[model samples]
Target: MKSVLQQLPESVLAQILENAFQWFVVVDKNSRILYINEDYCQFLEVPRDQAIGKPVDEVIENTKMHEVIKSGMAHQASPHYIKGTYMLANRVPLIVDGEIVGAFGSVVFRDMNDWKKLSSHVRTTMDKINMTSHEAPNKLYRLEDIKGSSKAIRSIKETIQMIAPSDLSVLIEGESGTGKELFAQSIHERSERAEFPFVKINCAAIPEDLLELEIFGANIEPEKHHRKGRFELADNGTLFLDEIGAMPLTIQAKLLRAIQEGEIEPIGSNMTKQVNVRILAATNRPLEHLIEQGKFREDLYYRIQAITLRIPPLRERMEDFTELANTFLQQYILKAGKRRLVLSSRTREYLQNYHWPGNVRELQNVIQAAVYLAEHEIIEPTALPEQLKQVRKKPVTQFVNLQDAIEDLEKMMIQHALQDEKDKRIIAKQLGLSRSTLYEKIKKYNL
Candidate 1:
């Protein structure tokens, strides 16, 4: 028996598809448009001839054709925002002979008024719920988003999986830009509270004067308007406190109380509201040292650190370096709407040799810059930043005596440390020397 498509002529079938769907498009496995109906071309204000062979994303605003092709999954009645209005769209992979060849997609709604009516009804229903004006931050990352396969990363992932089911407080410690927040989000996503809001606040970013109001909510002096704090917003969910070390000692006491009692008193309100919030705190600095220095509260430290996950810096996991670099490279390449590009062997060598002082975040920035600077399909050392270009393999040196060799090594170490760290105290601490001894060594070495 012949199928309907097989029985119909090619031109008739094309016309039927063009008129039947409000808007339709088809893209090959590479996300390059293979066929686009006349209606979609007219809507995009592009000629049919010009639309074909171009990337779907370039022609259609916020199109998921590429994602459908990549995932080989179908998106049915998904809300798609185009221009200024939201429309339902369906995207499905086009398979032939058990192989996905491309993707076929179309807008589901033919009448704009119908969609507007539905959208308005949904918004009205949401408004009735009295959702907070200050929306909870979206949990944009998952464990898969961590993007590393090193033993260190794998062990941390395993630990997160094991601890996610429990309600224990998690203290994530890592250097700045090591993706502590990503791990926090992953834990929330894997937990029982995954359906609830994953609220986050950066202690250092918020002003100290306003920080209390931000966390504990407040009633405006003149307006008498009551606002919900992060604690209330994160009720029955996870609250991620980023840069926890930077939280003021004054606020620390209240935070400890909330964690212990499961209640929060708004700034102006006399009554305390009960909230069930799972706390997940992250810090780039050593909280223990801060406690000793009378900066961070010791009790708060013990409260938040029921389970600790320490993320190793990029330098410590060199095995995942190339993979991470390539991942970032691909992301930037797609963002720039450019063809596929690869890092040259020499470029990779330079990248691996350089000490990533800024960690993963720094590497991502470097890759983004290199993607735009690259003139060819390959990213060479020339495309890297000036500092990265200056990085070179150290040469073997011969010394006259052991003392001379030791002194040279000491001087070299100091030079590298100076370049890596901006704080002299941190450098001294890392080198196992006191501030005075480090200064004397620096002066003696003329570093």
Candidate 2:
């Protein structure tokens, strides 16, 4: 049997190898080519009969494959040797017993013609195998879980819940960190098409040149193939466009076309595929301002504003500060694995008066910081960040008694004079007051 196998014709052996793979090649210990399948010949741009007895180095001279044989080890590279290519390969030495032998390998080619196809194939495969890719479509957060409980916030949540089942495009207006996207998610989860995808696209995140391709997708570069945009991904579902005010005028036109027609056409393709998507757009700025400035499209604004929802600033909803603070404290305590903490009466009082420039988002961040920094289970004023400390300090004085007020004013005035004049004697002269009076106020006020 060994003699018969050794005496087998090259054509018969090549036929067996071809049945096992698309391509195959074999070499002796001398690194001379002993066999080449039809696929291998075509891949190397050589004739099978002519390549059979030739050295692999001569067959594909100056190539990385030759280096593999020379070093007697497996070698792999990418976008290598061949121009305009991207390749992944596995090469392994075939050793028998204790004797050294030759090797075999395989390559998956990635060129301009096949890169898109390969990438798409990989994405589809991964999506099929990964539970995360297909589950619970849009991201989730709740209205009750939202930080505020003031009349404005209660009314807003009630409106959000009421409109949750509707298919109308929701326009969420709020400043940064007001959680417009959270509102968008709440709507989608409650909607009739909750099982479908909830695709999000940040209109302000992408460059104008690429935003078109990102939103409507493209096919001009065949290497990238034709991709489906957010609208397509959210078919029978919802699409959230953040910072909608920053979207370019030209792209706005395309968006309007898709909304009106209920379909999108890829950049390089003329065919339009119907998409069922309800758009929820959010922006901190006024769309009317953008329209007046000629920065946003008027028709598109009307299309997206079918049902507008405005979120009031934290300063405007100051009545909810304590509730928001307590809720945040509970969350932080649980997350930090600490004992339940009650806010100090002073802290709660000061919190209610804060302007909260970053709104609910800022409040959450502040409470979280305080929880981690607190020495005791109770959150004290000192545990807050330096910025919050400054905010709370100024506000706490507002609630002080008349004596404290007069004393604080006296201290402030003297500090200002000293800062301005750079000397206590000069400050007394500048304020038209005696040095003894200045010294007395300083001592009494603890300046």
Candidate 3:
């Protein structure tokens, strides 16, 4: 380039720059506007003469042009909010003969609708980034949102249906991300107390000092704004205690008494308020093991375990992964405003077979991240999270004993024979065994 500005006349240069931007403003070192285009003045609804003499910030809401002038540096390609709208702007120092005299600024898409259309895609990408990178949500799940076709899941649903109506203390045990809260809500909704509130508190999330105050209402001074605890708020309804195993042994005694007496005595209070609350407690920790270690109270365990349910980890229920994964993928795809992104069959199979140590939550998170990274509408296995992509299916285990090994081998051979040749005699002949022997073996192995 041969110094295009030098070759051009001042009036010609002004006309070209005016046409290039939706809005333009030039400010001197004092941040006093030296020049502003007619469009910018019209957008601000101020006359060009008035805008030129004033500071850019005084004229525009949320202006950062003053920053560029102060720092003598460029603030390029950054989002600048003006009048409750996001705009792409670049503010660069105007250096004349190696001396910083002023700054030049230009904006694109002054129309709010145009900015919204452009920024929507950016927002979608930002949401994806947040979903993948941030911590797990305190997600509330409904009974219908629960995904699984496995017998285990069916049984879990049936159990909730059976037990939810009852007024008993239910203890839920599972690995983290097994959706303990999901099950708890299902039970609550199915219960007679569904019309009332459902209050949940993670005993581990609150500090030990504040945990007592949170669970049992405090009777401290200035009682006007003093509020009820989880127990009082959940009166005549369901109270879900997450990570109940994390409660200190000292607090366990008080909790046990509350359950046993059907009332809670707040700290620093002699009076006990009667509460008809059904307790649903959950924990990833082994309560029995904790009791044995004397870290948890045995009496507390008995009180909470009046009705116990254990959710099997995701790896154990591989049959459900495909459905669960797609459910998550669909939710996130709609959230990101992307298409109905499809997962390749190979990707689905790989996901189903992989060991999900973090369970359904991990699967959902990985899918969200994948949806963000996917180039096309179809998400390949390569788009999966780094942890999931590195997962290798474990080799099938060998039989423990010679008798078991021989039995499995015989069973496999018999199944293959039956699959290929339907007739009993033909199957026997193919296996080099007599029909009677084959029948006896089939009956013995229950195959």
Query: What overall lDDT goes with each candidate model?
Result: 0.82, 0.71, 0.77
Work out the TM-score per prediction. 0.61, 0.56, 0.58
Candidate 3: where is the Cα deviation over 4 Å? 1-140, 222-225, 395-447
Candidate 3's residue-wise lDDT over 1-447, tens digit each?
569778999899888877888788998877789999876764554556557879878887777877887788898556665532345678898888978888888885433334346656655644554565446433345575577745567788778878888988899999999999999988888889988889999998999999999999888876634558899999999999999989998888899899999888887788889999999999999999998998999988888888889899997766566557656775676456564578886776678667888998888888888888888988998887666556587546464557655765776577557545646778888888997898777655433
What's the lDDT for residue 76 in model 1?
Answer: 77
User: Which sequence of candidate numbers ranks them by TM-score, best first?
Assistant: 1, 3, 2
Query: Which segments of candidate 2 are over 4 A away from where they belong?
Result: 1-139, 391-447
Query: Which TM-score value belongs to model 3?
Result: 0.58
Could you tell me which 10 consecutive residues in candidate 1 have the lowest summed lDDT? 125-134
- Residue-wise C-alpha lDDT for candidate 1, range 314-401, written one tens digit per residue: 8876556755776687667645656467788799878988888899999999999999999999898888887876676643435445
Better of 2 and 3 by lDDT: 3
Cα lDDT tens digits for candidate 2, 58-99:
775334555555676776423233211224455556678956
Alpha carbon lDDT at 399, candidate 2: 53
Report the lDDT of model 2 for residue 142. Answer: 55
- In the order shown, the candidates' Cα RMSDs to the true structure are 17.1, 27.9, 22.0
Candidate 2 minimal-lDDT segment of 10 residues: 77-86
